[model samples]
Target: MDFGLVLLLLGGFLLGGAWSIWRADSDTEGRTGPQVVFAVILLTAALLASVSGILYLV
Candidate 1:
């Protein structure tokens, strides 16, 4: 298991989530359009990271 890869993936997801939240709040409506899109990206990243971590454990 490569700790570096795991950390990298996790970090990327965290950054994406943060970016999404920021965008969501900074936009005019603050909860539509790109906000939903970015939110999905963040969720997908989180899911992938968790799956990767589980695989690494096993």
Candidate 2:
């Protein structure tokens, strides 16, 4: 398995997790600040990883 492919898979997994967390937090009541922040961070990381993976493959 190429490292780029691995990174792409990891990014997809992280993106899914971040989306789940964001959705769950949105459905909950007040004071989910930390979860939201974490989700955003995860989302950012995922995007960066995915971009890097694509670049690497190219």
Candidate 3:
């Protein structure tokens, strides 16, 4: 399999997980520090992976 494709898949999964976490956190009384931090990290990683994947494919 292509490395670019793998990156894209991984990015998608990470993005989904980040979104889920953010949504869940929002539904609660207040945002937890750890969950917010984790979600931000995941989102940043996902964006980086997705950009790298796209660049690789180009």
Candidate 4:
């Protein structure tokens, strides 16, 4: 339970949240540059967060 690990996981959540918003907005606007990238990055981070969180809880 290193503080640094917690911080890193939190950072991933923050990045994912931001990217999710950005991706959704871009999708709504019909843009396709960083939208997909953000969406993918967001999903990756979310998955990472879920795994990290589960491990932390365990």
Candidate 5:
């Protein structure tokens, strides 16, 4: 129940979702460069955040 942990998870979730949207947009626009790299990084961070959150809750 640490506030910092909660913030971490929330931030990760939001960033992941935002990146997902942007990734989709980039895909539709046919651009493959920094956006793709950023999307990957965000998704990875999101996954780590979710796992850490679950562990913290336990």
Candidate 6:
């Protein structure tokens, strides 16, 4: 099993979920676009880093 991938995915998931939830719970409706952008940023960064790390190991 790839531990780095696991960590990256879990971290991304937690961060993205937190970002969305935080945005949803907030009273500000106009800022969701930024929140979604942030979530995508974190998710993609984590995913790319994980894939590359795994590929390197493999």
Best model number under lDDT: 3
Q: Per-residue lDDT for 1-58 in model 1, tens only? A: 5875685579577667757575657444557666677777777777777677667667
* Tens digit per residue, CA lDDT, model 4, 7-46: 5677577676866666565435675777667776777777
| Candidate 4 TM-score over all chains jointly | 0.49
Per-residue lDDT for 55 in model 4?
73
Give lDDT tens digits, candidate 5, residues 1-58.
Answer: 7965895768577686756756576435675677677777777777777677767667
25: Cα error in model 3, Å: 2.3
lDDT of 2 at 31: 34
- Please state the error at residue 31 of candidate 2 in Å: 6.3
How displaced is residue 16 in candidate 3, in Å? 0.4
RMSD for all candidates, in order, please: 3.7, 1.8, 1.5, 4.0, 3.4, 4.1
Global lDDT for candidate 5? Answer: 0.70
The list of candidate 1 runs beyond 4 A from truth reads: 1-30
TM-score of candidate 3 on Cα atoms, chains taken together: 0.87
Lowest summed lDDT window (length 10), candidate 1:
22-31
lDDT of 5 at 3: 61
- Computed on alpha carbons, the lDDT of every model, listed in order, comes to 0.68, 0.89, 0.92, 0.67, 0.70, 0.65
How many clashing residue pairs appear in each of the predictions shown?
Answer: 0, 0, 0, 0, 0, 0
* TM-score on alpha carbons, each prediction: 0.55, 0.87, 0.87, 0.49, 0.60, 0.52
Backbone clash total for model 6 is: 0
Model 3 score (lDDT): 0.92
How would you encode candidate 3's per-residue C-alpha lDDT over 1-58 as one tens digit per residue? 9999989999999999999988885555777999899999999999999999999999
- The residue pairs in collision within model 4 are none
Q: What are the runs in model 6 whose C-alpha is more than 4 Å off?
A: 1-24, 27-31
Question: RMSD of model 2, in Å?
Answer: 1.8
| Candidate 2 lDDT by residue in tens digits, 1-58 | 9989988998999999999888784334853989889999999999999998999999
